[model samples]
Target: MDTQHDIALTRALAEVPGPLPVSGVIHVAVPHASRFTVVGNHLAQHAELSLTAIGIGVYIQSLPAGSQVGIKALAARFAEGETTIAAALRELETHDYLHRTRERLANGRMVTRTVFCNQPGALLRGGAVAPVTVASVPRPVVTPVVPAPVVAPEPTPVPEEGPPPVRLPSRIAPKPPRRPLPQPREPTPELHRAASALLADLRRHAPELVLSEGDVEELVPGAAAWLERGAHPDAVRHALTTELPQPPKYPAKIVRHRLTVLLPPPLPGAQELTAAPRTPVTPFQTCEGCDRAFRSPAPGHCRDCRAQYWEAA
Candidate 1:
């Protein structure tokens, strides 16, 4: 029974075909029945374009008319970052595969219009190629204009002249004046140092508040104004960092705004306020009379030793 089973297995193995060694890419073509996009070899096999650029070109070509193909949109759709996608888009534009035009609408709003060309080479060579349909939208037909026949001009008759027409100046509307920016006040050395330290420490509380050296210098005076106005360091910090925009785009701008808008009122008669009373402390002294440790104003003697000395004297 074992010999018969081994012979059957050997016969089955011989009947099966061996696996073929793959040296390169093997394509299995499947005919499309429904949704499909036809891409030309010129764009798919572009030598100058990077893989990312080629993929982006194919994607834009597959999109329907009036589709959003902006960098942010593409970045959201694909795993590529905005910078990489933006670079890819620039490559496509350079190769004439994509055209982007900024047009002002009838309502005075500006918008970007994008057009994709399937055969950019033919267009570059000045050859008329049929418009490539993207998705479902069809391209508009352009009509050629024929030149009108030229006619001879007739002689003009002289007319009685009246006063020259009054010339009117074109009406132009004056623009509105812009608001002036807040200026930083000159601060004392102590105030400046305190403000600088506070501004530098902001990043510890909120990483988004990281500031450059120039930014710290420029904003120091404003921060010093807050300190000079009797505002506590913690109060100023809270005002600058609390409820910060999800991620502060401009840390310096936010700092400047808080310093100006949330400035505390200066204390009235601040100089007249008396300092807090301190606890009385006795000085440590060694009594010469008794050679003992005591707490007294001077190192003369202890109370007990002083009484004894007076009596003995």
Candidate 2:
């Protein structure tokens, strides 16, 4: 048999007919003459042997040496479930078409070795069984890894009480400390002012939705996040307070949910974090007592009106 011709034949069969989108040697089995044998014949024609099992065996056989093969890897190749791939592997093992034997290395690591013998007596040339190739056990290489050179620390200076020490070159200085990671910048003065005004308005309009100092802290970050996304403060406030009933319960919880869930898409420069107003303010909640605009997320009267009403009482 002409071995050179066989190589040429294999290449010719695997050649792409049109433009090759990908340019890498694929580790795949082509229409080799020896691939067609009694076992392959039976597998291809027999309904008992599922096409999946045959394909699985072919894929495994096509893998290059030392390539990792797992149920997950196999399933990914065919876009099938891991369980399905595992079952197909079992079928291949049952038919003596493939198998895996484990070998533990000197480093206490166990590795699975895949062996292929699907066409038991079939070779690529004729329908002759191909010889099974078993890889020799991998001996662990214990090559000593040379560690990096250590920098000697500076020697501590001794007091003059001792006899004059032998004059030698000065010792090395200690390494400088590593710089700390940068923390997020505190909210800008403008940002703080805007956020506080929003908080006050929310509280004034929704008197039932009172916000504590701690609640304000929790709510500010979410609103800032929306602002960073380029949403106007007014939009964020409306989205947060629009659904709340007058004197709504659990103001903190309702506001947190709204801030997190109802975030608007960032406008072009909203992410730039400027203090200047990008959008005109549109008031949503107004004070019940004085009919003034609501400033905080909580339901309530404006500070001036609420204070005056208390004074009158």
Candidate 3:
């Protein structure tokens, strides 16, 4: 009976579930003998960094010296767009994991240099290992043995020719005359109001075009000139807003440049307004003899009436 009880207890225990197997990551780490990068837990488990940024930081740290890590190069290697890669690089820079600076090369070309820090905190705290300086050893001076003295020959001088030839002056090409700037029309109250409204409304099409009140007032004359020249309001707006720089440094300056440089010529009919007026046509006159209307310079008679009177004479 004891054996039976023991067997029953063993069966019951076997049937019961032993704490459900822990559901979590299991490390299967392998010791790397070569070509391995050591990443600190601070960076690998960074709370603020996104997965892409952390991964990029680690990749940059692992790269050999003088590797191309520009946004375009990184984008080509990874499955990310240039913008995303650039943002990740900026994130690494912000966290002190990376330092990028624009340097001008000896050839006068600008280049960006990137420096990766394995231990950002250490670097920030100025904890970098000092370079080892080797002490210079003194060498024993050797005595020189003197031999028989030898005489040296002197160089022969050449005779001078007549006066040096005169050099002709180089001909300089004449510069082309610059185009005259377009002058703004005399601004009336209506023109000023229209120009102001156009300048203010530019921000609606492009948020970067936001202008201050003073800038708008200053730009009003140029915008008015565009309008006075036969350019439609839409055309002027397109000229001002289209193909703007990635981030316009000075929006008002851009508008002013476009207004002055791209101003259209005035309408053809506009210039012909000073021509003489046309003479009026002859009016219709009623002939007194036949009671018939006819076109004449005066109201006296028609052609037929004048012919009859002449015949009677």
lDDT of each: 0.76, 0.62, 0.76
Candidate 1 CA-lDDT value: 0.76
lDDT of 2 by residue, 1-313 (tens): 6999899877875674655447676444344322222234655554665778887766655554455556766667678899888888788777766667776656555666666664544533356433434334345422222111111122223346778779888798989764331111456666656665676578665566678888886567666666666678777677866757665768887877777667666565656766777785655568888788866666778889888999999
User: lDDT tens string, model 3, 94-114?
Assistant: 998888777666755566667
Instruction: State in Å the error of residue 186, model 2.
Output: 93
Model 2 stretches astray by more than 4 angstroms: 1-39, 121-313
Best by lDDT: 3
Candidate 3: give the clashing pairs: none
Candidate 3 minimal-lDDT segment of 10 residues: 145-154
Q: How many backbone clashes does candidate 3 have?
A: 0
lDDT of 1 by residue, 72-165 (tens): 7789999999999999999998999877777666755566767677678877888675543323324433332211111112222335789998
Return the number of clashes found in candidate 2.
Answer: 28
Alpha-carbon RMSD, each predicted model? 21.4, 27.2, 18.9
Candidate 3 regions off by >4 Å?
Answer: 1-21, 29-34, 72-83, 105-111, 129-303
Could you tell me the lDDT of residue 301 within candidate 1? Answer: 87
